[model samples]
Target: MTLEEYKKEFTEDDAVGWLEIDKEFDRLYPDQEPKHYAPPISYMLGGEYPLDGVSIYESKKQTDHFHFVTYGFSELYYNEEKVNGEFSKWGFELTFRLKPFEGDNGNPPSWAVALLQNIAKYVFSSGNWFEEFHFMPANGPIRLETDTDITALVFVNDPEIPKKQTPHGEVTFLQITGITSAEYESIKDNPGTAEELVNKLRENNPLLITDLNRK
Candidate 1:
């Protein structure tokens, strides 16, 4: 929306951005209730987690996996000062798709929740943000203490959720996909290899679901 248009519709307690996100997800999932995780206190009040919350959905695209989308990375609430801005807080929120592991029994793993929180903590603390094809090392197994080869991450735009422009700004759903140690090293060996690796992964796994069993 243009600045003039925004001014014409502005409200002090307007939750335009937040409601837009919810409306998109509601369209996708219909009547399903997603599993949501959030810290007890709000981040503005110095809560432990940087994100306001994460909502997880069971997706059957390509394979059965849990889809995690974050909140609090953007200007979720209304603010006249930021009307019709180009981008939200950092212009994006993190998303992840993880294949169901053994013993999940239809329940999304807790580690996924913790992983998002750690990523948010890093961004909120270091004032750094991630973008398409950016890769990072987890320093250990992504699922710590577990015998897994997925120890790193690479980002890409979420295939399912398209970017949306709200009254506050535009928000991109940046998806985080886990990778193996060999894959991580290969990216490091060749500075721009992450995009290539992600392309290869998409050949067989279009959704880029992070499978702990992957090697």
Candidate 2:
């Protein structure tokens, strides 16, 4: 859209960018109400967490799994001055695909929300951004207090969601996929091999869903 049109539409609408994100999800899941988790008070008003919210959606694309998407990583509010920039705040948001475990009962677990928030806290504090093939050790089981061996994470572009252009800027969805302890060791020292590892992972798991029970 033209800059003049953008100003006319979003001059006073603070949720211009937010609505764009919702539009994408709405197209993919019409009439679906995602399970949303947000801080009691917003971070702008001194909430402990940096992320504004995370939404969990039920998916059965390749298998039954929960799709978690994060808000607040980018410029979710309207700012007239930043309209000409090449990218929004960070130019990207975080996403995750998680397979349901035995006790999930068709609902996303609280630990998953906490995990996303913790990652957001790191980005907000450290000014670091995640990219495809980048990996991190979760220090222990990704699901805390669980016996699962999925102890690491690696990033890739989400297969289903493509980058979008909003009046604010461009946004990319970076999917965070979990990895096992052995998989972590294989790529920790050799970051260049991360892509290769992901390819190997996809041989059996096409969607690269994070399965906590899998060894």
Candidate 3:
């Protein structure tokens, strides 16, 4: 989903927040002019973002919450000068607080799950601005972790070859983490049912489950 669509679908108060980066770097060997290389990096607001915002004391004082980090990488190319190259990388880190809506009910709200999943999909999806990407979970399992309320997810993107050398190259690897114990058990108990759950979760929150199952 586009940034505008994301904003529209999830409100700032919906226990979800994210951070994004779009950057360009220049490489130079000697006295020659610097070539421009733009690499985009996007991230969702994770435990780090909130802590940086309200001070460590405030964030540490909080009891219940969730955190996630994701990264993406796109193809790169040298500018006309050939002195440098351009590579696109986008990523996001996110954090969510359950206190806002926890007391409302016993079971977690669909919106909460949807929001988290949506953001996850955006970070891991190949369709995004990245040619390839990887996700890493800070806490537990990568795919489905439902046993715990608070969890952390992370993603990273690294290209095998330099952008100038292989502008159209593909991503070699991707990693994701932060699965809950309950989620693990669910999958373990019901072998082939993981796909069904993934589909259901994606249907509810398209933002988080972008093409994860695709080879």
Candidate 4:
């Protein structure tokens, strides 16, 4: 659905601030866990020759960003030992540029809250089929804007797979423009008859989340 349509249906509460969608897939079918990778290290032996050591390491990364700021999460796996396994979490360097909005005089718009809730619902329902799903606002500055368009960065889990990714199972970045509470109320009262109005909003302020990446 269009952003304005989505906003009208869901943005009933003002307390809603941010929304995110996250998904999980079976990295391995038949209940097998994905293999972990290791980093190779070289060490000096007997102060003469160099020796190589193989060190086991986790093989995944997670990140999130809003408006030139970023936040990250962790991935953990349990081994047969039930105690020994792999754990990796990066709460580090990543960023995105924030678009300035006329209404955001330092205050976010009310629509942001509803948008975030809808995102959470979509992710939870779609990703629940996998083993687990994790969702959280990547700590940073995410705001609504009127001047620029934003899109989600789409990426593939396996680049070798050749164009398997559709507009699904990826991050969704939203852009807000020329929208106000009065306009929203008009659409709500009109229901399905407001296609022209919806199109106007879509034409004037496009909302898209494209270019999803796996990094």
Name the weakest run of 10 consecutive residues (lDDT summed) in model 4. 48-57
Runs in model 4 lying further than 4 Å from the true structure: 1-98, 102-118, 121-178, 202-215
Arrange candidates, best TM-score first.
Answer: 2, 1, 3, 4
> How would you encode candidate 4's per-residue C-alpha lDDT over 1-215 as one tens digit per residue?
33354355444442111112111222212242422211133111222111111111122222111222111111112112211112221211111122334454534233343333333334334642111111123222223333322222111122111112111112222122222344444545664434454355335323211111201
In order, what lDDT does every prediction score? Answer: 0.87, 0.86, 0.30, 0.25
Give the C-alpha miss distance for residue 93 in model 3, angstroms.
Answer: 15
**After superposition, which runs of candidate 2 have C-alpha atoms over 4 Å from their true positions?**
none
Give the alpha carbon lDDT tens digit for every residue of 1-215 in model 2: 66787778776756877787888788878888999999999999999888889999888788988988899887888788768567878888888989998766766887888998899888889999888899998999988888998999999988788988878788888889999999899898788999999999899888788999998
Model 1 Cα lDDT, one tens digit per residue, 43-158: 89978898888999888778878888888788888777777788888889888999988846667888888898999899989999888999899999898887899999999999
Please report the TM-score between candidate 2 and the true structure. Answer: 0.95
Clashes of each: 0, 0, 37, 13
The residue ranges of model 1 lying beyond 4 angstroms of the native Cα positions read: 2-4, 7-10, 103-105
Candidate 3 Cα misplacement greater than 4 A, ranges: 1-169, 172-178, 209-215
Candidate 3, residues 69-118: lDDT per residue as tens digits?
Answer: 22223222222221112322232223222322333354333344444445
